[model samples]
Target chain A: MNRIAAFSIGAASGVVGTYLTLKEREDLKVEPKVFKYGRPDSPVSFHSYSAHSLAYDRARKIPLWVIERLSPHDIKKEITADRHRSNFQPDPFVSPHYSSANTDYFNSGWSRGHMAAAGNYKHDQKCMDDTFYLTNILPQDLDNNIDYWYRLENYCRQLVKKGYSLTVISGPLFLPEERDGKKIISHQVIGDNNVSVPTHLFKILLAEREDEEPPLLGSFIIPNKPVSDCPLRTFQVPLETIEKHSGSHFLQNLQRNKALDLCDKDGCKTISLNELTLYRYAQKLEQATSKEALEKLWAEMESKAIKLDKHITAIYKKKMNEF
Target chain B: MNRIAAFSIGAASGVVGTYLTLKEREDLKVEPKVFKYGRPDSPVSFHSYSAHSLAYDRARKIPLWVIERLSPHDIKKEITADRHRSNFQPDPFVSPHYSSANTDYFNSGWSRGHMAAAGNYKHDQKCMDDTFYLTNILPQDLDNNIDYWYRLENYCRQLVKKGYSLTVISGPLFLPEERDGKKIISHQVIGDNNVSVPTHLFKILLAEREDEEPPLLGSFIIPNKPVSDCPLRTFQVPLETIEKHSGSHFLQNLQRNKALDLCDKDGCKTISLNELTLYRYAQKLEQATSKEALEKLWAEMESKAIKLDKHITAIYKKKMNEF
Candidate 1:
């Protein structure tokens, strides 16, 4: 039997002593970040420089969980996009270290998806580059990466904009895929490095209100496929579903008995930038002097907004209502 | 000058003492609901038979506001439609009241819109019929009554289904309309009863969680026009906007420093029952044994879901994601 033991998660605040432990598999070594809360007599991490902590699984070469404390201030920074591929450096912090090479993605159809998006940590150049660490990269479909997943990332940012300070945990799921009536733990591998390609990726956003009310939780689980066609809400699952699949618990200490009602299972219709931009343009068209021009613009926007997919249309309907 | 003084809102629990008063408009008598909270030290009115309370404006023969406590259970009870033109009975509760006759609506090119919809109080037959009172009725556009306004009503019910206990305040808005740089409260009066025909109607839905968090507020202001061409979200306004126009406050006692983040100002694409039903049917067809049949069904559902209004399509996208 594998040993299943709890290790105290160290933090400057003694109150935040919750643990993230394994169920039964001890083969993969687990290490929680030693959180250094700043200032004396503060019951919480009030002024800590670091906004995130990670527990990596050296065996999988991916993080077990990348927990981040995101605020509006963090996302407010403007950072230049690092479009040029940077060097994949191994963190000296991990013992028995293995560096993931950029060559591992050579000729592979998958895009190097960021588990913790670079856009999120644009607060500082160093923090932005820290997201480039090989462990944060997961094999993702290009369409899913830039489109479907991007919508969720935008929503998280929007939540922050709405004055919510979120504690987000993102990870990959290598659940057993059923084949011919049998559960099989099979997945694709890339390069000689044997970097495991996850079957699914998930993110759990725990949105905490400033008023000390129970947190609003939103969990998204999407297959490692082209998800641009689907709505963001479609990937929404109950928090319990994520826990059941990953064998991991999140915010268990802070959540206590609070209910997670943020799934919005009925879902939201997420819109593309083009669509949103078009809608904003349409709003401007409402003030057109020429009746002909206004009608023409209305007709064009109407067709696009009306002919959209149900989910997108739903989002469109919402936008239309705002008008 | 009209006296606008706050009145004591009575209930067993002192917490239910939130007042609803008017601002110098004593011409229309205002009497806020005196909520009767049940035993067990409940801060709110729970386990009470009545779903709502109203403050009717006797002079206008319309309600100043109709506030209702809505839940899934309140909407679950089956009540036969009150068709065949029910009599417009006068609410005896109001002082120095005069009964509004059905003849007032005769030859009027408008439908009698229920401020608090009849469908909402379907829990009991008497309660449902109570909505037919003349004070609850307003001169509404036929298209707006049956379509645009109906969509907002359906959404309120859906929110209740999602575990929200909503306090809904529906009223008529007689805001000053501008004509050649002139602000005028120009409105039509129908029949001898002098029933004021409002240019627009508004509803404020404050969804309170069971856990006692600050309520989520959604304010909608729909024009009394052919709103069938308009989406439900197009009418969404801020809570502050409603207060500024009406000169009435809401949730003042319950909400302290907490920000009202419930308004999806950009808007959510809320769905219609027909759209939702069709989407569910589409999901079932995915497992069809016959490939040709499955393809045919998919094509049909796809076109329907895709071609829906932006709001419905957004909902459709969420449903599609699940599959």
Candidate 2:
């Protein structure tokens, strides 16, 4: 890029113009006409992180959207982050007043839920901890965060396990409801900082198709309240619906009809906690089989033989092989 | 800038990366670390215009904020754009469903208020017309839009007339209000598209200081409803208040105590409509004075002389010269 010596015509000396050093922007993206006199400095900032990237909505004290890329290998890694160690903390990068604090969610009957879903970033401890930052948080209903939202996250990982590169975009929504012949957008704001409690939360799952041209684009908008045993498919919505309300576009090349439906391609059903409990129980049962018990007995016998002497251990090994 | 052959790591092949063709982004602003597997694509889209620039909130269906630049010379231009000819229209750059339309405002009771007020872009017709696009609009209270909001805009122009170059950052605010025991953020949504009627509107005025280290930064948050003739200064707030609520920092160098207050520096009082009406009336009265009456009499005499004869007109001019 050649050095374009021209300056913006409009006198836009707002704080956002200096977000990056002028010298940094001196190279490009400086449209002479737009910033003819000054930069088109809007009151918004973009921040990128390891596990996820987000556009924080400073006004709402919530992220506009939290974006994350997930792969089966990353999700299925044996060594994952420990949730107990990571603490919910205010984002240091965000100004104190704009960044949400634990106090905001304290005694407010709400939970600070991760939009980037900490469980999804399990490949590394730091990557998982990154999702704990309030910048990636949303004021969510307690029961809903634990039950339905938790299950939905698993559903995302399940898709990855099925072998598609998944992009998860999640955020809060202040949906308008009809009242007195007029639609009203209303939600609770918690704490001294007044973090908004969104009326609804949306998650868009964009998965790359194996054979199709455009990726599978699926979006869902669910209420913040708990849904008792309701199918996840009930929340399914057109990707455009989320885009229009969120004021963002997903993929330009995406085609709805021809593109594989995420739900149809891979069932929208979530594995129940009861089933997971039983599966763990069955694994324990499987480990206690006669062959496993015999192996354990042989190991104990070998240890006893070692206690006796090296000659005894050699004799014990021969006996174990014969068995 | 070298051709960074690296693609993003966490797969973020969302639409935003393709916003300005992938080729354009091949050089810079594409941080390999952030988009290590894919792009760190957030749904938010930034659109720059001749009169203003804005970050459209895809979820909220409103601009996160509107930025504009103003100067005294531009405001005082002899020939300005005619507002009557400009029509309010949907922003073509925005998708149909996401973009606000005229039908969205039809019979909604709320008025489509311009964030970058049309009056401020009077220098060029096209610039003034650009403000009419819905991308620069917010659904606002009609009375407030016409009276108090209108005055605030004129106040901006008047500030320009005072010689300081001004930057106005304006947007809707759904501030939390204490109700019953908890704080609630509530606002009306109008029409089929559910366009949000912001509970409050804010204007942050950033004026260049002649000698001060940083610019004067002042902001105000006024309700969407009429103020019942209250002084505009009553709504004066610290710049941080707006930034904190909006979630975007204005200027990094701005120190509230050291930097001048825009309201204090310019005198927060707005020129009221009554005062404006009286001033216009006074101007009309000033035009019809005694000197003007004497000139009118001579002109009538000259016309009468012409009716009589050309020689008589010369005599009348000579006689009138003595008077």
Task: Identify the candidate with maximal TM-score.
Answer: 2
What does candidate 1's lDDT look like per residue over A197-293, in tens digits? 6778889877766675667767888887776555676787876566444434455455435744565521344666565445455555645556566
Candidate whose lDDT is highest: 2
Stretches of candidate 2 off by over 4 Å are A1-49, A121-123, A161-165, A207-217, A252-257, A273-323, B1-43, B121-123, B207-217, B251-257, B276-323
Clash totals, every prediction = 20, 29
lDDT of 1 by residue, B55-111 (tens): 443334565556666776656667654543345554433222222456767777778
lDDT of 1 at B248: 41
- Tell me candidate 2's TM-score on chain B: 0.72
Q: Which ten residues in a row have the lowest lDDT in candidate 1 chain A?
A: A38-47
**In model 2, how large is the Cα lDDT of residue A216?**
73
Interface alpha-carbon RMSD, every candidate: 31.4, 12.4
TM-score of 2: 0.72
Indicate the worst ten consecutive residues by lDDT in candidate 1 chain B: B38-47
Off by over 4 Å in 1: A1-50, A77-88, A94-97, A264-269, A273-323, B1-323
What's the distance in Å from true for residue A91, model 2?
3.1
